[model samples]
Target: EEKIPGVYGIDTRALTKLLREKGSLLGKITFEGGEDIEFHDPNQENLIAKVSTKEIVEYGSGDKTVVLVDCGTKYNIIRCLLRLGVKVVFVPWDYDFTQMEYDGLFISNGPGSPEFAEITVEHIRKAMEIGKPICGICMGNQLLCKAAGAKVYKLKYGHRSHNQPVRLVGTEKCYITSQNHGFAVDNSTIPSEWEPHFINMNDGTNEGIRHKTKPFFSAQFHPEASSGPKDTEFIFEEFVNLL
Candidate 1:
């Protein structure tokens, strides 16, 4: 593990920890075209084999929850998920795949204007159409609203601080949250199929929402906050239960 201020790098040990192997490699490396040994040592320089894994480049996962992310937004949420025993997969959220097979999906926070993410939106739509248990925060939340036929509107002044207060709606409980988004789900554009789950008590803007029927939900705040309050971190618990 290498950390230099805001940038970090991953090496082979990180890969091992991510594979959840107690210093053990699972299965065997197999080559394409089907004519080779199923197992071998990594030291074989003469081996003619290559295997492709549906790798989680940025996020970490357990043996179960296969979480996904919107590229670079996977940092803090991944740490929380891993602590909760989840197997995460983080890749550029805009990749096009005809079908996806995963136990669960988690979209992480990222910077930028959410409306410029058309490709990412399409991928999210496909994931939603597949109907797997999904959770999203920040940009992930915005994408969820977009996938569910809700409109995303930019705030005149975005919430980009860590000390924002988010009300859970039904309760007077207010969680001090970490947030960084200039856009929010237009409450009026939300379809009846979805129910607002959390709200920003300060402005009454939509903060979190869940599907009325499907196992899809999102939050506009960052719950997996590192170096901040973990008050809203229970969202990961909710995800584990939902999945």
Candidate 2:
């Protein structure tokens, strides 16, 4: 707001905005492509740019679900998962899964090559060793594919927007989805232990996978989409059912 300036960021937990009603503060906050968050900060010069760009624990915990997170997908993605009766925990890319504990795990949406996730892969291997219900999306999908003995190749320019055509593996039905990623799972290297469930109709890329014998599975698109099509919203129901 021109009349007021506030703190803004891609992390939309609403803490900075709520703190703005003090009137003595000037805050101009905006979460990645989201609305502008403005208020007032009198003491500082240009308060909007100085509102501590650091990440202030955007995640919370609950008894219902647990999730692994990255820099992409933003906080809105987590909100959707929470609304579905899931309590999520943000696991970084390098934490040893064997050290920590949680319930069903959700590999979150993110950008970058899946190979960049050495820690996630290690923890995933451990989860599979014990048979956990895991779900991966976007980069999460690529990580699962690679962790289960598949290879990931960087796409030139990558798929960074919404509206992708995905087909159910057996049904041959198409579901348009919101996608954002720069890499894809190489089907040729997918291990027999992981069963590919969905395929991208446009590029023939691996869009989803499930373990043949484990309760874990994943999709390459966002079912928790902020405002995208709801064609795959049932995936959330299926995930809770699997849990």
Q: Among all windows of ten consecutive residues in candidate 2, which has the lowest summed lDDT?
A: 47-56
**Best model per TM-score:** 1
* lDDT (C-alpha) at residue 94 in model 2: 54
**For residues 1-243, what per-residue lDDT tens digits would candidate 2 score against the true structure?**
476655534455465465444322234545678876675534324221222122323355455656554435456666766777766666555555455466667666664445556666877788777665788777777777777888887654355467888898878589888877656777888778777888887778888788888788888888777757778978766776666
- Overall local distance difference test of candidate 1: 0.72
| Top of the candidates by lDDT | 1
Q: Which digits, one per residue and each the tens of the lDDT, describe model 1 over residues 1-243?
A: 565334236476777676554423335545459788756443332111121123436445466756465445646666777887877666555655425556888776766656656676787788887888888788788877887889988675577788988888678888998887767898998999888888987788999889988888888987887756779888888887777
* Model 1: CA > 4 A from native: 1-61
Candidate 2's TM-score = 0.70
Report how far off residue 112 is in candidate 2 (Å): 1.9
